[model samples]
Target chain A: MMRLRLVTALLASAAAFVAVSAHADNLVTKDRVGPADAPKSFTLRLTNDGPTSTDPVWAEGYQKLFSEFIQRHPGWRIDLERMSDNIGQEQARMLEQAKSGNGPDCAAVDSFVLALFKGANVLKPLDEYFTKEEVADLFPFIREGITGPDGKIYAWWWNTDLRVLYRNKEIVPDAPKDWAELKAAALASKEKGGEGVLFNGGRWEGTTFDWLANFWAQGGKLVDDKGKPIFAEGENREKFLKAVNYFKDLVDSGAAPKRVATIVNYDEFNAAAAAGTAALFIGGNWQYGQLKNTLEPEEFAKWTFSEIPGPTADQRSTGTGGWTFGAFSNDPAKVAMCAAVVKEIYAGPGNALQQQLPTAAALYGKYDVFKTEANETFAKALVNGQARPGVPIYPEISNQIQIMMGDVLSGTKTPEAALDAANTAVQAAFARL
Target chain B: MPTTTAAAMGAAQRRVAGPSLARRIEANPFTWLVPVAVMLGVFYLYPILDVFRLGLTNASLVGSDERYTIVTLQAMFENPALLDILKTTAVFTIASVVGQQAFGLAIALLVMRGERRKLKGMVALRTLVLVAWVIPGIANGLIWQMLFSEAPFGAINSVLRMMHVSPVAWLSDPNIAMLSAVISNVWRGTAFSMIVFYAALKAIDPTLYEAASVDGAGHLQKLRFITLPQLRAAILVNSILVTIQTLNTFDAIISLTGGGPGRATEVLSLFTFNTVFRNYDLAGGSVLSVLMLVISLVLALFYASFMPRREVSE
Candidate 1:
């Protein structure tokens, strides 16, 4: 009787195993798309690439939009995965996965990486799905951010960003319009017992961006028209050296904290600004939104934005920044669908206008201007805004720039020595390109 | 002569028949090995083989080329940032291991020497030490990070201000970041070494100590000779374990430093992670991983070969 019971149990287990195997085999893969008229079910994954806690309002806004998307697209499911504020790392991971031929059908990628992936043929060109008229309707800077060297669009801009000088109104009634005035303000703030100005002087990619914008304002070009790096051996070299020297002197004179060597991310510096410890900070516009959420309305009112001070009185410029959504599938139909989705999400009439209006309102609220006024100023500034050179060797160039800046900041190398070293490295990097 | 040869062969057969080799091992040895063997196969050998396979493929996010080459290794050597990372890793590992062992052994000796009146509290204190070890590594890093925050709101900075002292940039300064990581790790890991030493102390025969005491030996003298000699085995094992743990530690450093302030706290493992995950240079990451694996294997082999063997009495 015991043997018979054991046999019965074994047979039952085997039958259950077979049933499970069949069920698993029948499970639909995420990449499988059904016909339009057929019973369709799908899951879409989204990554926010920012901290969820600091921006609860923005997270909730995206969540609501996702729910609305699910309702609009019947028989489809979506799962949004929020990553911490490390968009560069996320883009690198997505790019790696795409090279392996198995990646997310769509991913939120930074504008810097969009060009790299497009050059590598890992991104699907979106020109076929969106017409030129529709593309032209986007903010020109946003459109330019996603355009490739071949003049094909590989991604859609989700949001746009630009660098602005954030100042404490109590410390300085008027924002400085040039570098010399800014330096004076910093010194004055320090003498008055506040951290004068805080730039991310740490060795990271952003530091290079901070340096290059100033260098460009001083008329320093990294590469000449012949595509050769020229910062070391010409009249332009002196201007680069002078700008860097001034920056170093400011740090050395206690206009900024000695701990500038340690600050890795803008958030840390921004925290100091919010606490009213720092007098001025150069940061992105999203930071204003972050400050709004973190500080009381009264504390928020202490801050305002202006253009970064230029080399001379006349050459002020903001550095343009944005993020892009790249499609990662080789399947034509899937690629087409992804492109359609990006357009629907970013550039559709209501969505595009919605994105613009909120950002403009947020900027105006913080800068103490009307939304219309802020929008017009922003539109005019876009013409003068400079994007980082879209070179494949940008990472290598960035590293060199950071190292050279580190030497100057540490007072180990003069500006001429540092810029010369950086120029050599830049030349090498471009040679690789 | 033939009869003599047959007798000799019978004697040899009798020796073999007394017990088969397998039966002798089974009769005299432990049974815990069956589960251990299964676990080692599943967790260690299987994953090692997977890593070996991954190392061979040129699989990257940017290309479909699966052909293996020395390109990754070349990249590893070519990257200039690796020198600073190696220095940081060495400093962190050495400091953490030495600190944990010294503090752990000292505490173990104190508990062992204390009078019975103090024994309960000492045991309770040891239990408290275990709490830091029991907490997840990332959580420990986060707790320490909060303690080390440079802002006036931070615990360390607040205390400094109350004492009329200037606050230090504990995480931001390159000179202090690795040391701070070591302190956090030592706090979490010392408990393990302490427990091992405690067990070793308990295992030492009470008669040996009593005999030494009868000879009019002082407490320090007894510890120097009897306790130290008896605890050598435990010390060796604990050292090996701590070394391996310290060398491979990732979560603590990553959560604390993120290898920032210009790669000031980056270790080999973090460098490997950045290479593979951040830079998509899988080949270079694999080479670094392989180098780390080889170093670990050599250390393990040296420990196994040099460890003093136990003897049996007749």
Candidate 2:
């Protein structure tokens, strides 16, 4: 009854908004434009790469949690604003807000972007807020990723989405264990009259994530601790070349679609999978949502996911990409509250969606998705999952690498030339750093 | 009427009143354009000058830091991809602008001719062509992607299957990516030129065509002589305007190809966006923006030089 009233109030305000003005500015947000009703209100406005989903349960959870927090500290409010879903735009906004020394107490920063925030000195270290035990409970690599060189934790990751091998059980009914087997499976799936294997081969950071995951699996190093290009010299070049060559081979082979170069991001890949055209999609595990949401029951049953196979046996690897809640403030009082909010939303057993592997670390087995054998395999894969280079210059490095991946995938440049060219560019980027 | 002469009375009144506001405005036309000139200076010229200032420094989208450097400009010139990207931008701008003008004029002429003949479908056809133009860039990209994406599932592929022709990779291969982008863009952008040309064609005196027809001139000859001559102003204006628009085409290409198939269609605008926003290099992006400004200015001067000068009637 309470939830229904809130929903009704929201809908009524929305209708009023539409009636009052046909303008889009008023249409998007339910929050007030300026000033709080009370003096003690902490306007913890936030923005992210995606809008807050309207899942009532998830929202209700946050609302209840927020009300409780407000009740405990009397006369306080949280005013969150969403800027954009674009990473680069959001990063700029976050930095600008940080420079102003106000805005949301903090925001949910993507894992790859923590380095940028840290570099900009916008991130406030979380050392004083969270206890040592809480810190230890988090994934070590994640901890390492956020921790600056000065032993200060700049951010805490909320979730992770890894590149997993998804295939149709109806065609080629079995999962591939290694790189060779995965290729053979692709060939077999093609033979079965399916559209065969598909990768997120489009030009963007998505391509870089997919490419780097495979490279790590093949024992190719992207950078050292100092964020220098490792493949710029000697034997590493040949190893890195193999990764692009694999993409080239995938396209060259009849297994992958001739138009694999245009496969793009998850949505494009998901459409093919939903249409039953693409039998295999090597992409993020988050596609589970689309599979469940978009596909028919019978179709959903045929789809299953497994580890992204490595070049050698027992050499599984995947890359974890997800968003994290990070704060940027110099004030200790605001900093403390930021930590509390981050922990309350992302830490421990709280919201079901937030409890997932991508958002949080603990209580994975408790969730049905986590309990599944496939996800159990994903969890195991996470143990060896490669984290992206957490450095200020990583975005520059990734940009050049994405271009190289595009070059190799589109057959504009051979793998050797493309990879070599990317190495030189990356070397230049590192030199700047 | 009681005055020594009405002309003498009017001349005395004119001398007493000096010049009326309207007469003064008519005497110096550019005087009325002062607000517009000021607005252009503030909104347009200032930003270009600001970009130059930024290009000379290292001020970025981050914290209050005392950092200014000329190394960004040096590196931009030194970058190997600069030449190739500029070449791509040139190809894209020229092809897209020329294509937009040609298709737009043809569509406009066809529609105008049809309208003159009292054709029923002309209105609907004009409205239908604008569907591509009116749709948002992101939506247009998505719609085109669904149509041209891959084989079997894509709309084009389904048609290809019917015709027994092999599927075309619309956005994948570098050999075809720029052409694909141009085609997609031409569909969305040509309507602007069409609208302009349609209005221009409508404004032309019909008696000129009638005169040409009576002189034993064919339809093609009339078009070549009267139509072409009259439309040159629209053509020049649209060419410069569309050239800038196409050169600065970021959203459509970003949403569709993303300067991809390995930078095959990486125009300067997209490259600048990627440099600043994506790569987090503000100084470098400013230099590129300055370069884009120079390119547009050159085109502006070139187009303005050919613009017909108004005769001083006074």
Per-model TM-score versus the true fold: 0.78, 0.88
- Candidate models: Cα lDDT each: 0.68, 0.76
Q: Quote the lDDT for A373 in model 1.
A: 52
Sliding window of 10 residues with minimal summed lDDT for model 2 chain A: A26-35
Segments in model 2 whose C-alpha atoms lie over 4 Å from true places: A1-29, A32-36, A43-51, A54-69, A100-103, A348-351, A358-361, A365-369, A372-374, B1-42, B60-66, B312-314
CA RMSD of each candidate after superposition: 10.8, 6.1
Task: Show the lowest summed lDDT stretch of 10 residues, model 1 chain B.
Answer: B56-65
- Give a tens-digit lDDT track for model 1, residues A271-386: 78666677788886657767777778988788887788888778876666666667776667656656655655443322233333212222334332334454555555555577
**Model 2 lDDT tens row, A157-232:** 7677688888888886888887778888898887777777888676677878887766787677777767677865
In candidate 1, list every pair of residues with a backbone clash.
A96-B61, A99-B61
> Could you give candidate 1's per-residue lDDT for residues B127-213 as a string of tens digits?
788898998887887788778876545688889999999898787666677788899999999999889988898899999989999
